[model samples]
Target: MTGHTKAHTMVGKSSQSLPKRILHSGVILYVALAFLALIYIMPFIIQVATSFKTDADATANPVSLIPQVWTTAAYSKLFLNSDFPVWFKNSFIVTIVVTVGRVFFDSLAGYALSRLQFRGRDIIFAMLVAVMSVPMVVLLIPKFLIIKSLGIYDSYAGMILPLLIDASGVFIMKNFFESIPRSVEEQAMIDRAGTFRIFWQIVLPMARPALVTISILSFQGSWNELSHFIVSTQSSSLTTLTKGVASLASGQLSSGNQYPVKLAAAVVMTIPVAVLFFIFQKRIMNSSEGSVKE
Candidate 1:
């Protein structure tokens, strides 16, 4: 009876302390994370505040959290004088096409690698892994050479085709494909469905999470890509937001330092990605969760 009483007393004590310990740990973690978040967000906060300041104010108090004198001259110049509209259009067009192309092509290739049986399959997979590891910066000159030789320079093809199939997207799709149970495909095969039909109809629908991941990555990458667009095209017609903003930053249009114009451009360029993030946020979260579960 004493032993039972002692065991029950210890269990009661532990139960009472568990909540307190968890609460203490949670508070400590929250404080640390909040501090880090503030540190990271401070620069962007300053950029936004300073963007509203006049040229004189901006120059004198660059680090000020609030503008002494606010002005809309920068935004007016961006809209009225610059080719910001053209840059925005190019970014939108390229981002959409690249995102769709990558999702479809990469997923197809990945599905083939995961399921298809043919000679040289293992070799192809190994080559893809090797290709993915190759540094992107190193390929800049080579890609330029290829684009020039193909006679596609200054054309949309030069900009789009080279980025249509990325190795990282292929890898992500392959991983997601592998996570799926083989029995699903086995049943489809028993039905004597064509391989492409089974892959397109059955497998692709189940790959929404991986597809969203590839789409987001591709959109962001192509939208923010400056160097590739620089090498691929010379005309202002094809200049993307990144390239145009870079030119604005380096004083292409303005003779002197224009903090408001540059900061507004930066903020404008960030809006599309921000919208994409929020729109697909739930899907992204669920996708990550599903990946973890797998």
Candidate 2:
């Protein structure tokens, strides 16, 4: 009887301590995540703060997150006194066209590769996979050569056409299509729907998550593309935000280092991409959840 009573007392002590242990662990985890988040976000925060600082103050206190004297000179210069609007216009046009083209072409190729069984289909897919493995830097020279040979160099067509079909986007869509039930397409076929009809009306709508993913990726890639723009076009009017900002950083706009203007340009360039991601984040999460369930 005494031993049983002692055992029960120890069990009570363990139960009482369990909540405290859990609370301690939760606190530690929260702190760790908070620190990590801060670390990742600190650079962006500094960029914004520095954008509001005067050029002299920004250079003087480069490491400081808080500005000594806030000013809108950087913004005024970018919007009022520079070629920023033209750069922004070029970026927007290229990004929009590229995103739309990629979504449509990638989906088409993906569906064909995933569902069709033509001769040499395997060979074609293998080639695509191999192409994806090739680094973008390795293709820069070849890309330039091809753009020149095609007589589209130093033009908008040179910039937009080459990036329209991404191998990775095609791969992503193909994989997503394969996960969908074959019966879905088979049933549409039985209803006498044409291949294009089924793909466009039925399968495409069902693949919203994948489409959104590709759209976001294409938009971001084309918006931030610098090397391609550099090789394809030489005109200042054709320059995108990335190239224009790079010039700004290299002292094109001023004699001394204009840190505020450069940082402001950086911050503005980030807003479009950030907004795009946030808008599609829910769709991405939902698609992930659906994939998990499937």
Worst 10 contiguous positions by lDDT, candidate 1: 285-294
CA RMSD per model (angstroms): 5.5, 3.5
Give the Cα lDDT of each candidate: 0.87, 0.91
Best by lDDT: 2
Measure candidate 1: CA RMSD: 5.5
C-alpha TM-score for every candidate? 0.88, 0.91
Over the stretch 74-102, how does candidate 1's per-residue lDDT look in tens digits?
Answer: 77888889999998988888888998999
Q: Write the per-residue lDDT of candidate 2 for residues 93-191, one digit (tens) a residue.
A: 999999999999999999999999899999999999999999888999999999999999988899899999999999989999888777777778989
The stretch of ten residues in a row with the least summed lDDT in candidate 2 is 285-294
Candidate 1, position 247, lDDT: 93
